[model samples]
Target: MDAAEALTLLMSPQGRVDPYPTYERLREHGPVVQALPGLYVVTGYAEADELLRDPRLGVLDDALRDQVWPNWRESPAVSSIARSMLRTNPPDHSRMRRLAAGAFSPRRIAGMRDVVRAQAEELLDGMRDRAGDGAPVDVLADFAYPLPVGVICALLGVPATDRPLFRRWAGDLTGVLEPEITVEELAVADAGAAELRAYFAELVAARRRTPADDLTTALVQVHDTDGERLTGDELLANLVVLLVAGFETTTNLLGNGLVVLLRHPGAAAALRADPGLAPAYVEELLRYDSPVQLTTRTTTAPVRCGGLDLPAGSTALLLLGAANRDPRRFPDPQRFDPTRDQAHPLSFGAGPHYCLGAGLARLEAQLAFPLLLRRLPELALAGTPRHRTRLTLRGYQTLPVTLGTPAVADRGTPAGAHPGTP
Candidate 1:
């Protein structure tokens, strides 16, 4: 397929269903294909890997963002993302990244282990009740979505009752990240961003009066205690970004991982038998069906890559999903093998901008998969799963599953569940 034709398919609903074919078609044009006069797409593993860490290929900083969308500040969602480290570069990015990284310290994430287990158990209890009598339940909505939400909320010290508010707000706010968003989508994002800002502002105030051990409180302390380091706007925007980032991609990871496990019954069974294999299994899942697919970088200076020479100020669209499955990187790239060695996928991206929540996502999945397999002995795909019609983040919209209870003693008293759940 021609470059234009391949891009057209990639942007269409058909590509949303299976964009791998289109990625391959684009790859045929070479590692880097010029889509337009100044726009290029990189689909090769080596090229993408090299470019992701190249500082010369940078993101649209604040000045450029203002130029692209002059009235962006009018939309809370766009403005929030524009201000956060998500879009910043260089000296600014370095400081913001340092503070954010401190908040998600290794000790903090490790401490959440017990909390994650408890939350997973509670969610599983609810899932079991909903699937009583062998009734089918939508895993995507019932389990996958709520599990991450619960985990992230617990870390942020958000109360259980207020948890539901994030579901709608996160969806509305995150739509702006898509490659093609409609006018209506932007409006929803604006409203969501506004509400999030207000909510976090109040929460930040509450934390100031009485400090807590949560991530939000930690951020509030930093912002107020050291005004020169983090501004009020940066604090609010980071909070909003954290709440969304904490769970959005993870929801996809859990949903997609379950489907992969089910398809390979042996892998599922092996996991049920021995949960120790979770680390490797989770890595393969990230490689097999990545939660995120693509990202972009702009040229800061004239550079040559992937056998192409381009002028400065050009946009390079990095095809992460394609690079993950590139034959040069992984032998038999299409197959799902948990046993595969050194399977380093760009699913979470690379370089200084690597996903902040990647470690947490892996921890959640590693814990989740084992518990899921053991609890639902008769668990199986009960209906056809539908993929979300978005290419940036790939996952299911609804995953119907059956949870039948056999009289097997092994299914008794799963670790995460409370009393009388079995």
Candidate 2:
């Protein structure tokens, strides 16, 4: 397929289901191909990595959006995302990112390791309890989904009881991240954004009233030595961004990681044997099936990329999934080898706009995966797994699996022992 066709196919559901072949085609044509007028798609790893870090390229924020799509601000969902640090550039991006970094410190994220383990164990215990029913459990709902949501909620100081609310709102809001979204989806996302804003506003006020040892409280009170900090609106917008971003991508990572593990029995067995290998395993999983497939950036000045000269005001769609699998950067790129000694994947992105929650996401996955393998030793697919129909976010919507009875500690115990047997 040509560049245009390949780009079009990526927007189609079928292509979303499997975009690798199209990516290969795009890569064969060139590392960066002009997919359409004023639009380029980057398919190679080195090129994408360099372009992502290029200062001349930046998120299409309000000013750029106004020039490209006049009615962009009409959609609350779109506007919400546009205002986030993900879409801002330079001064605004720097300010907001610094504030967020202050609150999401490494020490804070490091402390969540134990919390991640406990939550993982708790979810697996629930899955184990249901194993006796001879019914398939959805790994997405029972484990992958809850683990990240729970961790993010705790980090944000949101009540665990309100997780269902966040899930509903986040589910609706993420539709805006797609390459193309329907009007109905836009309406749903808009409404969800309004509700989320109101909800977080109240929560922020509560945190201000009663300070707690949580990120929200810290964010609410954070300030630079020069008295620079997030404005009220910036605070609200970023809080929403943090809550949604904090879980959405990580949720996808957990689901996709589990699917990869289940499909690779040897790798899973290795992980089960040596839980310490989880950090490496998670890295491979991120490279193999990134939670986010594509991210867009706009050119602020004329630049040369992928052996082509592009003028200012151009848009580039960095096909991160394709780049991650690019053969030039990854030897045997398609192989799922945890032991592969390779540079970091562009999964969490690169440069100034790199994911603020990358460390937390990694910690969650590193801890969750090993715990999952230990808790669900005989976990195997019970039915065909289904992927979410999202071009930007790639992950399983439903991962049906049966947790076979856990082996007994006694060596003499017969195989296929009753699931409930001690």
The global C-alpha lDDT for each of the candidates, from Candidate 1 onward, is: 0.83, 0.83
Per-residue lDDT of 98 in model 1? 84
Using lDDT as the measure, the top candidate is 1
Instruction: List where candidate 1 sits over 4 angstroms from the true fold.
Output: 406-422
Model 2, 311-333: lDDT tens per residue?
Answer: 89998999999999988888998
In Å, residue 281's CA in model 2 sits off its true spot by: 0.9
Q: Clashing residue pairs, candidate 2?
A: none
CA shift of 172, model 2, Å: 1.4
TM-score of 1: 0.94
Note each model's CA RMSD in angstroms: 3.5, 4.8
lDDT of 1 by residue, 40-131 (tens): 99998889989889889888887777777888878899989877888888777778778878656778777766667677777788888887
lDDT of 1 at 408: 40
Query: Estimated TM-score per prediction?
Result: 0.94, 0.93
lDDT score for candidate 2 against the true structure: 0.83
Lowest lDDT block of 10, candidate 2: 413-422
